[model samples]
Target: MNYLVKINAVKTTNELEDAWSNEDYKALLARFEYPDAAQLKPAELKEYLFLAISDFEPHEAAAILLDYKCSDQLVDGQIDNLSHEMLRTKTFENYSEIDLHHDLFNINQLLYSAYNGKFPLGTVNLVEMEIKGDDNVEELTKETALKALSYGLSENNLINRLLSDQIEGHKAFPEAEGIVWELQHKGDDVYTLTISEKWLTKTEITNPEYECTVVPFEEHQEAN
Candidate 1:
């Protein structure tokens, strides 16, 4: 019998200093109400952004963060006081997760509290995964795993699906488990798959879990 085995995945957090490069700066300035926002230099841009985001009420600031694709990310382990202070308070209050290593830093997972009512930005994307009941785990790929993690952590996914049985309790607090997956793609994009000894199995969100371990895995591979 191939009952699924499980391993530990850590919830690792990191900050990307250049997540938004000079290329992004132009688009960022374009959306702002500031007429000269696009013309601002480094120093001027920082001043303008800081002013625009820093002063609004918590809810408004959250909108700007998403709408503007704000540069800041929430992180742990000795983060500077100034940076934390500058980030919108609602993000932390409403809560979101951080994807440490990827092509682009996925900022907020839109776990926005409904206290402010829903908006267009409330929706997020989901990555698919196929769970099989066997030792033949070749179906799972690194790319697929990464996509699953992102979708699982997303507000829409969480609200829709209950992860308590998969990990410790989706984004298990205090006692976090590590998730690891790898895949090698050939001509047709099929994966040469390798994952942690324990793989993930998806569960329905409607089920109320009594004591499920919905663990949020930490990705060790960084984007090259």
Candidate 2:
């Protein structure tokens, strides 16, 4: 039986709750001919429940959990995090290899300049580019290459492809003015890129008033 179809067919929360209570859900799962169904643990069953309700493909959901090395005791928060990652995966599903390579070229160029030519080109893989501003650092998988590509273009991310191209020779010197970029080697093909503002020049601004009026309560009441 189609796993998603079967699970989704349970139309009501009450039905699902009752099925679980009566072990009817086990019978439903048994019909799917899942490998080693009898040996499945509570955590695995909970993951299956999460997958059934999620928007991702069953195989994709399973793969994501496996890649993250989720423990036997899956929780709601973990499922939520997985869902977010899956959304990023979907967003970049159509990202082409050519575009990816182009971005990679810029990234490698920046890295080479940052390391003073010591870092070899074409060594950084898609998985090595870390996403910025995440609460927890996630080790991206090959399937999440598109997510990396998207994050790489942002100013907050490690790659900062656009910023790298704008700087002369793609080199970020310590004494550079304006925004300063820094690269740190985090070992075993991992690198962290960060940026900070320095000697920022402020621009004076004036707000021009548009055609507008703030009416008093008495005038507003009279108009109404």
Candidate 3:
């Protein structure tokens, strides 16, 4: 089945930088709604920016960040400061397997907390799916397919590997047990993903599994 994965969140520094490019210092200060934004030095400005956007949804914060324009030096410095601050507040170091799992769950929660629970934007159907197995091919509901794709993509290893790869065509990911993923480059900053999973059998339990396609959020929106 074909699924459309809408990436509603900005995950990289470069992407954020590319989204907005106005470097007017005064404008940057005004955008964040700082009362004394003009009086703040670079360090103070960075701190205020963090504080100002602390309560914002990730997408909203991201949109504001895209609108930001400042000198390259200042942008780099502020982004570095903000990134450190964000990680410090938003993530914690995991000391054990349980802690790691907890942290992963938190990350998932944070992703969902964006834009009224439609965020980190997992997979959704562009068309109906057909679950295919050795001797059976059955129509899968859109809802079930979405859940499966979302769960599959939620695996950290799978997502990390998928985003990191810049090459086109079939790729190998030995660490992502029970999951099979393929990439087809569509254009600049856009690609199609085909992912399949059979990890349920790891517990010696058999279940139906299916393949789905994913594309950029913008493309998916345009198609609709």
- In terms of lDDT, model 2 sits at 0.29
- lDDT by residue (1-224, candidate 3, tens digit) is 34333332211110111121223334544765667776777556544555665566564554454324222323555444433433333221221222222222223233343334543322211111233322224333322233334433433433334533311113332323212222333433233333321221122212224344533334445666
Residues 1-224 of candidate 1: C-alpha lDDT, one tens digit per residue: 12222212222223224445654545544543546765677656645654554345534544444544534553332233312432433222132332221221223322122222222222211212232223354454433333334333423444224443333222422211112222333333222222221122333222211122112334222211
Each prediction's whole-model lDDT (CA):
0.33, 0.29, 0.34
lDDT of 2 by residue, 53-162 (tens): 24444434433332333234345664455434433342111222222222223322322333334323322221123233232354532212222222213344332343
Q: Best candidate per lDDT, number? A: 3
Q: Tell me which residue pairs clash in candidate 3.
A: 22-69, 23-69, 23-70
* Regions of candidate 2 where Cα sits further than 4 Å from its true position: 1-33, 36-68, 72-75, 84-224
Deviating ranges (above 4 Å) for candidate 1? 1-14, 42-44, 68-140, 143-224
Worst 10 residues of 3 by lDDT: 10-19
For model 1, state the Cα shift of residue 31 in Å. Answer: 3.3
User: Which number leads on TM-score?
Assistant: 1
Q: What is the lDDT of candidate 3?
A: 0.34
Task: Score every model by TM-score.
Answer: 0.30, 0.17, 0.23
Ordered from best to worst TM-score, the candidate numbers read 1, 3, 2
